[model samples]
Target: MTSVLDAKTLRKEAAEARQMADAISNQQDKDFWLGIAEGWLELAQAWRSGGAPRSTKLKEDSAIGSLCLGT
Candidate 1:
C-alpha cells in the first residue's frame, strides 16, 4: 500500500541525495548520487500516483507466470 507518508519520505531521500551530490567534488560520485536522487524522485512520483498495485510483487503462494515480469 503506497501512502502519502511514503512519498514524503522518498522526496526527503531525493533531496538528501541531491545535497550530497552537490557537496561532492568527484564527478563519478556526483553522478552516482544524482542518479540516486533521480531514482527517488521517480519512485515518489509513482507512489503518489499508484505504485503499490502497479508494483510487480507477487502474493504469497502466487507463482511466476511469465518471463516479462513487469508492471
Candidate 2:
C-alpha cells in the first residue's frame, strides 16, 4: 500500500515535470524538465518493481525520448 502511494506520488511528480517542460520556451530548459520527468517515471517504475532505479539511458521510442532527441 505504501509502495503504491509512493509510485503514485512519483507519477504525479513526473506529470508536473512534463508540464513544466511544456511551459518552457528555451530548448535546454525544456530538455532539463523532460529529463526530470524521465527520472521521476523511472523511480515510479522501480518502486513498483520493488527495486532501485537503473539506467539513465533514454528509450529511443519513448515520448520523452522523442522530445529529448528532437525526433
Candidate 3:
C-alpha cells in the first residue's frame, strides 16, 4: 500500500496537480488532461476507493479508445 503523504507533501502534490489542471485548454483537450491523468487518477481513486490506482497506464492505450471510453 502507498504511504499517506504528510500535510505539506499532500499540499505540494495538490498544488502541482492544480497547476497541471489549470493549464488545460478546454474540457475537450484530451492530450492536456491525459498528460496529467496520473495525478487525477490517483486523487480520484483515493476519494472513491481509498487508495491510488495500481497505475495510470491509460486503460485504453489509444486516443480513439480514450474518446470512446472517457469518464
Candidate 4:
C-alpha cells in the first residue's frame, strides 16, 4: 500500500520514536531509535520545505521502508 504522510504526521512519529528511545535501557537499542527519530525529523523538515520528493513504492528491505513500517 502507498501511504502519503504529511509533515505533522512525520514530526509526531519522530517524537514518538524519541520517547521510545528514552525508555530503552540498552545503548544500542536507544541509539537505533534515536536514529529513526532523526530520520523522521529530517524527512518532516524536508516535507515542510517542499524539498521532499514525491512518495514512491518502498521496497520491503529498504531502510526507509523499515522506518515507516516500524519493522
Task: Return the top candidate by TM-score.
Answer: 2
Cα distance off (Å), candidate 1, residue 8: 0.7
Residues 1-71, candidate 2: write the lDDT tens digits.
23455888889989999999999999999998998798779878988999966855556665555654688
Q: Could you give the candidate ranking by lDDT, starting with the highest?
A: 2, 4, 1, 3
Clashing pairs in model 3?
none
At residue 21, give the lDDT of candidate 3.
Answer: 62
What are the runs in model 2 whose C-alpha is more than 4 Å off? 1-5, 56-71
lDDT of 4 by residue, 1-71 (tens): 12778888888888999999999999998987887777777778788988953444233564566755677
Query: Residue 51's C-alpha lDDT in candidate 3?
Result: 60
* Predicted candidate 3 versus true structure: per-residue lDDT over 1-69, tens digit per residue: 237644445445545655766777676664554545444445455556666445555457643236425
- TM-scores of all models? 0.64, 0.70, 0.34, 0.70
Q: How far is 23's C-alpha from truth in model 3 (Å)?
A: 0.9
lDDT of 1: 0.65
Model 4 ranges off by over 4 Å: 1-3, 53-71
Please give the lDDT score at residue 20 for candidate 1. 94
Q: 1-71 in candidate 1: lDDT tens per residue? A: 24455788878977998999999999998987886676667667777888643333333332211211342
Worst 10 residues of 4 by lDDT: 53-62
RMSD list, candidates in order: 9.3, 8.5, 8.4, 5.1
Please list the C-alpha lDDT of all candidates, in the order they appear: 0.65, 0.79, 0.51, 0.75
